[model samples]
Target: MMFEKIANKIGKYTVLLISLLIALILYPALEQYKIGHICLTLWSLITMVAIVVSLNENKKTSKRIQLASGVLFLLIGTLLTRQVLGLSQEFLYHLILPFSFLFIAYIIWIILSSIFKRKSLGADELSGAIVSYLLLGIMWGLLYSYIEFISLNSFSFAAAHDIQAKGSALFYYSFVTLTTLGYGDILPISRFARMAAYLEAVTGVMYTAILVAGLVGHVGRHR
Candidate 1:
């Protein structure tokens, strides 16, 4: 049982860590990008295998956490590919908003998960539940950001440069998107991209809502 628990956490975190590094390698939007992309893909597959083994142990909290993280990680993995390519504002102009929202949401999710763990009731079960809830937020935030960024860049990079963007633009856009607050300075120029952005907004709202609901449920019912 203890061995299983340790493996489960290792698997989940491996997925998260590899995905983050892969994003960095892939977001440059430049040529000669194949190596990083392939390595990221391989790591993603390995993470999946680890998650599967961990889940097979079938502990309830582990199952739920793994399930949620697995699904989110898959999406996040796909999105991480974009991080390999978001290189210049010429390219970023198209993907700026999506990338921005994606990064911010991820940061929020990680921080929340960490805090949730720290607030434990001196019990493993409660702490795990809160951490799972937090991962749900993190997973959604990261997954949504990846989708948003790819959609924008793939569809709009050809419209020509609107000026170069710094790497920080992704974080800025991600924060706005994660908070569901859009200022309209950054617009999605294509139908799919627009819808992707909308979905991100919805996802953010739902994640926050779930976190609040989980907190309430834990307090009222778990106690």
Candidate 2:
């Protein structure tokens, strides 16, 4: 009974938690292996599925299943093109980044709608808020990767690393910038890159402040 209750309580959060864990721990740990990119691709697909499932929680069962199926189809196509097709990484990035941006935008809209709705905060709403913040970091990381792909040497790494700005490195940089950490190990050198870095930093600060204020106001009204 206790296990069942715990499972029910965390059911809504399971996918989100798994996505976070894969990105933060699993991906990073396996990144040095030959299967790293494969894992990364799988991670992205899983994240997309999680977002679709979360957004469709209120829809009819049939409609939810249909939407999830569509998303899965699209993600599978992307994965095949990346892995099976003899396409350059740059070409793959060009193809995927636009769709990735669209997916992130849609989920952010849905999550923010849930967060700002005039209702008592619940586990769903709280998780949506947290996921939305992480999504922002991911969105910025994608942008950073895109910028670096188009223009080499856009970001300078202080450490003597053979790989340029890409993959997990850019994500780490994004979160660091988002938190305004400015670690200086990775520095954006180009004009646009600098602008993006600072913009993310500002957005991070503003988002935290606004989210806290909104949650507090909601709590006060409920009381």
For all candidates, what are the clash counts? 20, 0
Best by TM-score: 2
Worst 10 residues of 1 by lDDT: 158-167
Tens-digit lDDT track of model 1 for 1-223: 5435664565434444444445445545431355654564556455445434533432654565555556546555555555566432234324433443443344344434543444333344344333343333344444434544455452233234322232224334545665778765555566755675677678668866886786666566645
Q: Write the per-residue lDDT of candidate 2 for residues 48-149, one digit (tens) a residue.
A: 555555555557643744564575557556665666454444555665665566566566766777667746777767876887888888888888888887
Winning model by lDDT = 2
- For model 2, what is the alpha-carbon lDDT of residue 206? 95
> Residue 46: error of model 2 in Å?
2.4
How well does candidate 1 match the true structure in TM-score terms? 0.43
In terms of lDDT, the poorest run of 10 residues in model 2 is 1-10
